[model samples]
Target: MDHPLLLAFGLLLVVEGLFPLLAPQAWKDTFSRLIGLRDGQLRTIGLIGVALGVALLVSFS
Candidate 1:
């Protein structure tokens, strides 16, 4: 169980890290646009995604 969690984390890190190296300018532009998003809006969107993910996981488990 722990091994799978660690593997997931490692995969996330690798994908996230590679994006910047592979597309630095695109990442910068995208992040700048993301930063323009209002805090409340971002939080709401994030919460919705988290909630959906949790529901799916719970149902699957």
Candidate 2:
């Protein structure tokens, strides 16, 4: 795409889809475990993901 935002979003989709595409069972298993996690734990995981994503975007761009 002509826009950097579109390019980044497309890359994000590709990366997000790869794991489930390659290992559907494993992907399901991961979410099954995630379901057992407490809300706080899930929040922490999500926060970390966001932080790292921001860090990577800053460093790369």
51 Cα displacement, candidate 1 (Å):
4.1
Q: What is the TM-score of each predicted model, taking all chains together? A: 0.68, 0.91
What TM-score does candidate 1 get on C-alpha atoms?
0.68
CA lDDT of each prediction against the hidden true structure: 0.89, 0.96
Q: Which segments of model 1 are wrong by more than 4 Å?
A: 51-61
With candidate 2 superimposed using the best TM-score fit, by how many Å does residue 3's alpha carbon deviate from the native?
0.7
Please give the distance, in angstroms, between residue 53's alpha carbon in candidate 2 and its true position after superposition: 1.0
Q: How many backbone clashes does candidate 2 have?
A: 0
RMSD of 1: 2.5
Q: List, residue by residue over 1-61, the lDDT tens digit for candidate 2.
A: 5799988889889999999999999999999999999999999999999999999989998
Model 1 weakest lDDT span, ten residues long:
1-10
**lDDT, model 2:** 0.96
Question: Which candidate number maximizes TM-score?
Answer: 2
Which residue pairs show collisions in model 2? none
**lDDT tens digits, residues 1-61, model 1?**
6697798789879988998999999999989998999999899989998999789768987
Leading candidate by lDDT: 2
